[model samples]
Each structure stands twice: as C-alpha cells, then as structure tokens.
Target: MTLPITTTAQVRQSLLDRHEIALLDVREEDPFGQGHPLFAANLPLGRIELDIRSRVPRLDTPIVVYDNGEGLARTAGERLRAIGYTQVSLLQDGLRGWREAGGELFIDVNVPSKSFGELVESQRHTPSLSAEEVKRLLDSSADVVVLDARRFDEYQTMSIPGGTSTPGAELVLRARAQAPNPATQIIVNCAGRTRSIIGTQSLVNAGIPNPVAALRNGTIGWTLAGFALEHGASRRAGTASDPQRAEAAVAARAVADRADVRRADTARLAGFLAESARTTYRFDVRSPEEYLQGHVPGFRNAPGGQLVQETDVSAPVRGARIVLADDDGVRANMSASWLAQMGWEVWVLDGLTADSFSERAPAPPALPAPSRPVQWIAPRALADALAREAPGTTAIIDLTTSANHVKRHIPGAWFVLRTDLPQALARIPRARRYVLTCGSSLLAQYAVDEIAQATGAQVLVLDGGNQAWADAGLPVEAGEQRLASPRTDRYRRPYEGTDNPREAMQAYLDWEFGLVEQLGRDGTHGFRVI
Candidate 1:
C-alpha cells in the first residue's frame, strides 16, 4: 500500500503549532539515539505490534513514521494500517529528508524533555550546590536533608551518603515532613541534571519555606569529585502529617494554577475518556507500590519523576491530553504543573476519596492477536527437547530486551531482536526445529510465522516465555553467553552505571549544558516556565 508522504516542513509546523501529530522514528534505539528530529519518538518496528496501541491510543490520530534509509518506515506504516490505524503516513525520504530540510537532529532519547529541562534551568536560574559543597555540609553534620528525586529502585542502587528517596512528585508533598524546621536546608538530587533541576524547581515553585538547591551534577558529580556513594539505601520519605498535607495541597494547587493546569472532576474525566476523537492518557502519577495497592480502574501507573523525564515512552502521541490522578492531591497537581509548562494539555483529577481507588494489582497490557496462528510448546517439553536432541538441533531464540536477556534467559538461548531476525538467523546454526521466547511469549508468538518463513524450519513458542520458565523452577543462564544481534535495543545512559569513563560522564554533562541553545535552534519546543 502507498502511504501518504508527510513533508518535513509540515511536521515542523505541526509541532510549532502544538497540533496533535505523532512523529515516530521507526528505528532501533541505538540508531534513533544517534540522530532524530526533536520531537520524534522511537517506536521500533519490532515493538509496533505490542506497544503502538497503548502509546498511540487514538488510531485515527495522525502519525508519521520514518527511518534512515533502512526502508522500515514503509513496512511500519503498512503495519499501522493493518492494525486499524486510519491516518498513517511516511516522512518524505525519511531521515535524510529531515536533514536536507534543515530539521534539527538531536542525539539521545527523550531529547524533548531533556532540552526542556535545560531551558527551565537557564530561564529560572535554578539554584544548585556543588558536590564538594554538599559533601562538606554532610561531613559537618549540618541541618540539611538530601532528597533523591529519582525512582525508588534507582535510589536503592546508589545514592548520596545521607539521602532519602523522595521522587520529584513527592518533593513538595513530603518536604515538610522530612524537614519540618523552616531553617533546615533541602537538597534535591537525581542521577543526572534534568530531574535535579526539575525537582529543585518544583520545590521553589511550590514556595517551600526551606532553602532548596539541586546537588549539582547529582551522583555523577559526586563520584567525579572523589566522594563515596552508599549502595542499597532504603531511606524514604514518609507520609505527610494532616497539617502538612493541607499546606502542601494549597501550595501545589497554586503552582498548578499558575502554570494554567486544568482541573477535572469525575464527570469531566468521564467526558475526556469518552472522547473518541482525542487521545487521552489517564495516569496515576504515584509510586508503583501505591498503584498496586489500589488505583482508579482506567489509570495506569507512571511514577511522576520518570514520567516527566521519559514523556516519549509514557505518551508517544504528541499533543495528547494527559490526566494525572493521585489520592493525595499534591502529587498530581505538582506533576500536572510541569506537564502544562511543557505544552501538554494536562489536568489534575480532583475530589478523590479512598473509595475511588478500588482496582488492585497491575493491569494486563492491551494487545492485538497475532497475525497468524502460532504453534507452542510447554516449558517442560522444550526443556526435554533440549536434553533429547543434539545441542544445536533445537535452537532457542530470545526476543526480549538485551539487558533482561543478559540478566536471565533460557539456557542456550541466542538473544536476537525480532526485527533483526532476517540477518540474525543467518548467524545462528541451521536447526531442525526452532523455539522463540520473550518476557511474556507474546513477542515470540508474533514472530513464529516470520522465523518459519525465513529459516524454513518448524518454529514453536515456549509456552510462557522466560518469565514462566523461571516461575516453574527451570534453570536459566546469565550474561551475554550467546548473541545473534547487537545489544542496541536500548541506548546506554552515561549516568546509569558505575563503570562509565570520566570523559563520557563529562561529555554527557557538556551536551546537556548546550541543550538550551539547541532548543532555540530547533524552535519547535513550546516550553514555558512559570
């Protein structure tokens, strides 16, 4: 099918006008991170069938997919069409066309949100304390509270010597409880700059009485400054007192009002959800634990700090309406205020009682059925086949993320990207029968026909994939034991691990420092700070 062509100029204009248009880069994370349009969200061709429905909920919403001479865009567009999308188009000539038309190409994922953070820091002049300075305060036992404005898991990984996990959304709400004394100093830190800036600014915006500043460069700077980090930290912010909650709600509401964030009651939320023409994302911007306890039926859990940092992953459909909910009024409003400033049509769900949250446990992902019938084998049966046949006779291909594959996977499984099957299959030894599995077996099920057609071998899916194998007390292997494809599914963040070279860490910081200028050059980011 011939997909309509969307010009670079049109896409740029749509972004500038704040129109609802999803600019997608249908390439793997590594390539997409190398270069892409400012607002282009990476939805790899392999994941389109599994994630497109949720990321771009409104099938009729305009979407333009592109690739860099990879020829994946046309296939992606066709796939979108096959899945009931009405308005799918291709970028004229793909990535090359964008560059030729002078469109700004940004490196790294979440460029839009990262650049917006740089802009916010530049305009607001958010206060910060150097790692050395913060260290001195800690050594002297100063009256200061260090708040790690990152996810709990990230905080548990590595944190400042004395820091508590109070994610960005909870900063304003929990700051009072952590530092009740008005004279106590508060320091916000994340792995890197964006969250630190945003978290510190959030406190300043909420009119927190205590002095607030970001830990400059966060843990990266601390490590570079020869400071030791504490691992497996469990410190976390507790619930706010009644008076603290009331004060925080008032302050957060004022900030949201200033940012022009809208408020909606249950009736209004129903109207937004019922609107078929618009894509509305209902999210509970609280921690995953809180979400699993109980949450609004339709709302998905997207922790507020990570949601702001990774908007592209949470809401790939640019210009979609976002409604945030939290039983504690403060988290939703605080998060909504930032979304509003980022040019999102965001709303805070008001008037939520304890009874409002009745649903428990994580919701199953919404997915479409496989294009064709798929043959399956039970985990034990597959285990027996491996023992019964020659080592290479029954080859196993794992289509899960490389990181997860390295952590735990079926024994002797060759990790391969589903989209890279054509090339990857040639590398793996020819086998009489092949087995495919992913985290849930869903992705593997979708690839059964493709692998069978390419290799001319009988293809069968592991009944429940890697998760089930582990669940049934099956032995699994770890590390990059076998790989048919490169580990490029996810771009490695410079600030994620401890082994990063000093040069790379410094280079990443330099890049972030220049994002303000990049934002100006792009001229499509409609970011405004109140």
Candidate 2:
C-alpha cells in the first residue's frame, strides 16, 4: 500500500507554526538516540502497537515515521494504519532525507525539553552553585536545605547528604515549608541538569524569598567532586500549611500569567475534550501518593518535574493542548508555566474542589487481548519441566524490555523482541516445546500466535510470567546471558550510575551547555523564558 510522504521542510514548518505533529523515529532507542531531528520522538517499530495510541491519542493526528535506512518505517506506517491511525505518513527518504534537507540532528533523548531547559537557563540567567560550594555549606552546617528534585525512587537510590525528596513541582509549593526562614538557602538538584535547572528556576519564578540556586550539573557534579552520596534515603517534603499553600498559589499564578499560560475552568476543559480535531492531554500534576488517594476523572498522573524533563515521553505529539489539574492550584500552574514556554498550547484547570477528584486509583492502560488462546504452564511446572527435559529440549523466549531482561528472567530464557520472533527462532537451538514470558506475560500472550506459527512446536505461556516465578520461590537469573536479540531497546543515560567514564559524564555536560547554540541554529523551537 502506498503511504503519504511528509517532506522535512513541511515537518519543520509544522513545528515552527505550532501545528500538532508527531515525527517518529521507528528505530530502537539506542539508534534513535545516536541522531534524530529535534522534535522527533523514538517510538520503536516493535512497540508501535503498544504505545502509539497513548502517545498520539488522536487517530487522525498527522504522523510521519522514519528510520535510518533500516527499512522499518514502511512496516511501522502499515502497522499504524492497521491500528486505526488514519493520517500516517513516511518521512521523505527517512533520516537521511532530514539531514539532506538541512535539518539539525540531535543526540540523546528528550532533546526538545533538555534544550528548552538550557534555553531557560540562558535567557533567565538561572542561578547555580558548584558542588564544592554546596559541600562547603554542608560542612559548615549553614542554614540551608538541599532539595533533590527527582522522583522518590530515584532519590532513594542516591541523594545528597541530608537532602529531602522535593520534586520539581513540589519545590515551589513546599520550599516555604522546608525552609520557613527567608535567610535559609535552597539548593535544588536532580540526577542531571534539566530538573535541577527547572526546579531551582521554578522557586525563583514563584518569588520564593529564600536564596535559591540549582546544584550545577546536579548529582553528577557531586559524584565527580569525590563526595559520598547517601543511599536508601526516604526523606520527603512535608505538607505545606494552609497559609503557605495559599501564598504559593498566588506566587505560582503570577508566574503562569507572566509565561502567558491560559486558564480553563471545568466547562472549558470539557469543551477542549470534546474537540475531535485536536488531541488534548489531561494530567494531574501531583505526587503519585496523593494521586492514588484521589484524582480528577480522565486525568493521568505525571509529576510536574518529570513531565517537563521528559515531555517527549509524556506527550509526544508536539503542539498538542495540555490541561493540568491540581486541587492546591500551585502544582498545575507551576507545571503549565514551563510547558507553555516549551511551545505547548497549555492551560491550568481552575475552580477545582475536593469533590472534583472522584477517581480513586490509576486506570489501566488499554491493550488488545491475545490474538488466540494458548496453553499455560505454571511457574513451578515450567521449572520442573526445565529440570526433567533434555538440554535444549524446552526453551523460553522472553519479550520484556532489554533493561528488565537484564535485571531478572527465567534462568535459561532467551531475551527476544516480539517483532524479531522469526529471526530469533532461526538462531535458537531447536526445541520440542517453547514457552513465552515477559514482565507479566501480557505482551507475551500477544506473541503466542507468531511463535506457534513459526516453530510448529507446543507453545505455552508462563503463567503470571517472570513475576510469578519469583513469587513461587523459583530460581531466576540476572544479567544478559542468553540473548536472541540485541539490547537496543533502551539508551543508557550518561548521567546515571556512579561508574560511568569521567570523560563521558564531562561530555554529557558539555553537550547540554551547547544546546542553546544548537537551538539557535535550528530556529524551530518556539521556547520563551518568563
């Protein structure tokens, strides 16, 4: 079937004119991270069916798929069409075409958001403190609070000594409570630079009287400076008083107004939802713990800081309208302010009450059921079969993300991408019986038909998947030992982990510092700093 082609120039102009568009690189994360157009989102060909609906909710939303001569774009386009995506197209000549058309290629993920953070820092001259300075302050017992502006899980893994888990949106709302005295200093940090810069700037923008500064280069700088980080830390921000919340709401609204973010009441939000021509994202920008207790119906929970740091992942469709909600009013306005400056048509939902949040739990993601029924093998039964059968007679194919596969899997399962089942079948040793499993076996169930077709052997799915194996007290293995596919599903972040090459970490920082210049060259990012 012939597919429409979107020229590189047209894609650029769409971005420049604030028209909704999803430029997708239909390659795995590793390759996509090596190089892609600034606004392009990496939605691998293997995951298109699983992720496209959420990423670009509007079936008729204009989408252009491309790959670097890997021949995946056409197949991706066809799959998208089959899944009811009505306006799918191919990028002319794929990645090479964009390069040839004088479009700038960016390395790493979330280029648009990261570059916008750099632009914010450049335009606003966001204040920052070096790791050494922060260390000295800690040593001196100065009146300061180090706020780690990352998710609680990330903060638990590692954090600055005495640092509290005050994520980005929570910064403005909680800073006053964390350091009630204006004389106390506040240093905000993240695993890397984006959240650090954004979090620190958020407090400044909200007119926090405390002297605020980002931990320059964030935790990476702390590690490089030979400082020891605390692990298993669980310190979290305390609830703000009614007075503090009221004060924060006022300050945050001013910041949002300065950034030109629009306000939408419940009626207006319903109207935005009814508009079929545009895709609108409804998000409750609050802590997950609070979100689970109760949240607005039809709104997903995305913490404010993470939403800004990973906009491509959270809302891939560029120029889509986003409506944010929070009962306190501080988080929504603060998060919307950043989103608006990042070129999104964003609004903060106002006139909310405790009664507005009626949903009590997170909604499950929509997924297609298994194409056909298949036999199921209990985890213990499978373990016994593996022990009793001859070597290579029973094989397990795992379809989890490469990262999760590396973390844990059945002792002898072969990690494989669902899309590469045919190719992978050829590589694995011949077996009389095959079993498929993933994190929960939901995705594996979808692949039962393909594997059964190719092998013609008795195919069974592991009941409850890998999780059940662990729960059943069965043995499992970690590390990448048995692999039928390359582990390219995830691109390792240079800023994560402690053992990364010093040069690589320094290179990452250098790259961020240069993003402003790159943005200037591209001229398509309609970012503004308030």
Candidate 3:
C-alpha cells in the first residue's frame, strides 16, 4: 500500500514545468482509450470514488496514476489517497513505465484538446478551406456559409456539402447568424482537427469581420477530398440576432480583453460564488435551447463550442475559476477567449441576462455534473420490471460502456463493470431484482453500492439510465445484446465511430502529426499555442 511513485521522468518533468499536473489514466474508459501519455486524463477506475473531487479540484495539484499493468496503479493510488489526494502518485512502471520511458502514447479522448488543436495548426497558419477550395465556393454561387464547428450531434454526424450547426463557442456569436453577408464566407467544420482549429481560431480570435476559414482538415479533410459527406445535415445557427450582432459583440469584447479575460462584476460575481476554497465553474455559453429558455443565475449550460471542446468535460478544475455566461457579448467573450487560452481562470459574466434567471427551475440540467445521490428505479418501474421477465424477479445490470452496450441497451440487460462486480456475481443469472443501469444512472448508483457490498445484491438503480429507457417511449435493443462483460471497458475510439478507416482516418491524422514532437518529448502540457 505504499503509494508515492511518479517518474515517467517525473511525468516528463511535470509537463516541462508549466506545472498543474493531472496525468491520470486509472484505466477503464476503454482501456483509457487504448493508449495514454499525451497529457493523460481518463480517471476511470469505476468513477474513482465518483470522479475525484470534481476531477481533481486542487487537492494539492500533482496526481499521476496510470495502469496497463492491470493491477491499476496501486488501486488508483489507494483511491487517490482515500479520496483526499494531497498529491498522489504511481506511474513509474505503469503503461510499461510509459513505454520504457521514451514516453509518447496518446489515442482518443481529448488528447490534450486534440494535441492542442494540432499545435494550433502548427503555430497560427490557421486559416483554411480546401475541399476543392470549399467546393469551388459552393459551385460559384459564392458568398459562402458553411459553419459546423462540431456538435449539433457532431454537425449532424458528417456534414459539409452545405454545413451549418455552428458549435465552437458559437463562432463569434453564430458567425453573425450564419454569414449575414459581410460579403459572407465563414466556413468552419470539425470531426477532426480539434473543432476545426478551435472553430476557425474562434472566428480569428474574435476580430470576425466575416472571413474566417478552417475546413481544411475537418470532416477528415472532407474525407480526404473525395468529398460527398452530408448525411443528416439539417443546417443551423439562427439566433444571436445577427446583422453582425453588435459587431460580434464588439469583437468579442476585444478578444476577452486581450485574453486577460476578467469581468465578473456583481461584486466580483458575489465573491466568485463565495469561494470556499476555489472550485468556481459558473458557465453558461448559451444554447441548450438557450440554456433551457433562460439562464444566468449561478450559470451552468456549457455550450461555447462544447465548452472549449470539453475542458475535461467542463471545468474539471485544472485550477478552476471559469465564470463565462452570455446574454451575448459574443458568447461570453468568445468563450472567455478560449478559457484564457486553456490555462483557465477565465471570466466574462459582467451581467448575464434573460434577467439573470434561476428563481425556480434548473433541476439537474445545467450539465458539468457533480451531484451524485442515487438509488432508484422509475422508467415506469423499469418498464414494469422488464414486462415481467421475472427471472429472479428482475436482472437488469448494465453499468454502461461496451460502447454504450453496443449503442443502446435494456432489452435484455447484462453488461457489467462497476469494477467488475466481484467477478460480475457469477455472470448475473442469480437475481432478486438486480436492476442497476447507466448512461446516467450516474454509474448506476456506483453500481448499486458495489453490487451491495459485492453480492448481497438487491440492486435497483435505473431511474434515468439508458436515458430513462429512451425518455420512456420505451423499447430499445441494439447489438452485443446481453454480455455479462467483454468489451474491455471502452476503446474503439479513433475519434469515435462513423465510417473511420481511411486507414483509420489517416492513422488519426498521423497521430495528430506526431503531437508537436510529443509535446516536445512529453515535457508536460501547459499548452499555450494560441
């Protein structure tokens, strides 16, 4: 049980001394997405006692963890020191001591924001287009539009022939409502190359006079230029009340005040929500149906190009204090100028509106979660106990990944891994209402108290798992039908499922063009190419 360890050359010299280290792998998001290192962060050993204090909210910064030796880095370094984590360790020989110390391994799940958007398009040569120069400016009807910036379900999964969605921090307030003719142009695109080079350098760092670019390496360079894309499209970006929404809210508040970004106001945003040892967050970045029709009050909605492409899923506290919000000052100053170029201590809230909401509503939907208080069953009582399949009165089980149990579950529920329920309770046939579920049962109530202390089983957790059985219209059943477990925890990622194989998308863009020489030999990523 002796924990303190480290040295993949001191986590590559504490990310080359820019400092704040997380580097956690703790194995389980599909084998931490089949490889590790480029600033590793998965954090999965069955939700590390429920995502380590909001994913390491500074319990003395340095963490290490790592696994691939199977004995999960000394049980995730004794569960990050029994959940207090005042600097835990253990990597030294995990993932084979980071490839025998030469380091470099990255694959999938936000490899440091996709290798810092391929090192910010190899240092700012960021403008782009090329799918035959945006299909000859849409076959010469010119005055372009395009947009997409990944996530409207990845711009309706594969777009381009006319693009639209507008996700990444809403490209300077929805690219002036999708190109309101400042002699048009725009472009954007994602699904490869970090939200289209941070959504066309977030409308060229918010100076947006409509002439941004980035489609070049997106939709995987329009499927390596053979082109075609468009499945499901459904164009988007429509309401920031365009006509260049007040000059893109004054050039996105002068690029969030030249990236110094502060402006919380309201008495320093009520002393940053009463500090209490610093785990701030407050987000808004508009559009989850405009944060469910009204927002502001202690924010939460995180849309601003998927909050800078999932800042470790919305402020995983890499030194917290994020504020942001947006009654349009060009989307919380272009998402607080890319979360203050990703070092984050960002701000922008100077008066959010719809008159700063939250008098009543806001029940668990402003995302960036942290609530965990499970134990339930209602998706119509697990659809009347799975229509009385009554085999031991019920047996559900699921616990989530195996690629979301082959992309949907419940019809016959078998999946496992709440840390493999004590050898998965002998492949779960012995039930007495062992319900549990995932995809939002919040790790099925931590897999029903570890399958009720490993086999006292009366488990029941399915309240909103399988998205409350597909929002209660019920009836879901996809492949890998009912396996007690074999999907090796999670990895088939290669930027996740959709036609991949253009040699696995050009070997995932040649491993993001060798991640800036492996962040210059894993010299720790405090990454600042902005």
Question: lDDT of each model, Cα atoms only?
Answer: 0.91, 0.90, 0.73
Off by over 4 Å in 2: 369-375, 419-422
Give me the displacement of residue 135 in model 3, in angstroms: 1.4
User: Model 3 clash pairs?
Assistant: 15-523, 15-524, 16-523, 30-490, 30-491, 168-305, 169-304, 169-305
* Model 1 score (lDDT): 0.91
Q: For candidate 3, lDDT tens digit of each residue in 1-530?
A: 68788788766765565455677777677777777776577777777766676556556667777788777678768766765667787877788878877887866776777777777788888888777888888989888888877778766766877777877877777676667667788788776778888878878877667688887777776777787787787878787665568878988888778878888777887886666555676777777876777776646677887777767755544556777777768888877776677667787877645556653346443122322345587888768756777556777888777777788887878888766566767876776657787887775775565576666756677777888779888888889857776776766655544677788877887878887778767655666654
User: Between 1 and 3, whose TM-score is larger?
Assistant: 1
> How do the residues 1-530 of candidate 1 rate in per-residue lDDT, one tens digit apiece?
98999999999988877788999998899999999988899999998989998789898999999999977899899989989999999999899999999998999888878898888999999999999999999999999999999988889989999899999899999999999999999999998899999999999999989999999999999988989999999999988999999999999999999999998999999998789888999999998998999999989999888899889889988889999999878899999999999999999998889999999976777787888788889998888778878778989999999999999998889999976778899999999999999998988888887888888889999888999999999899899979999998998888887788988888889999999998888888889988
Candidate 3: count the clashes: 8
Looking at model 2, residue 501 earns an lDDT score of: 83
Native-structure RMSD, model 3: 22.1
Return model 2's CA RMSD, one decimal. Answer: 1.7
Worst 10 residues of 2 by lDDT: 363-372
Local accuracy of candidate 2 as per-residue lDDT tens digits, 1-530: 79999999999999988899999998889898999999889898877767777788898999999999978899889878878889999999999999999999999998988999998899889999999999999999999999999989889888999999998899999999999999999999997799999998999889999999999998888888889989999999999999999999999999999989998999998898899999999899998888999999989999988898889888989989999999897999999999998988899998989999999978777655555797899998998888888899988999999889999998989999875667778889989889989988877887787788888888999989999989999988899898899888888788776677878888899999999999999989988887
List, in order, the clash count of every candidate structure: 0, 0, 8
Which candidate has the highest lDDT of all? 1
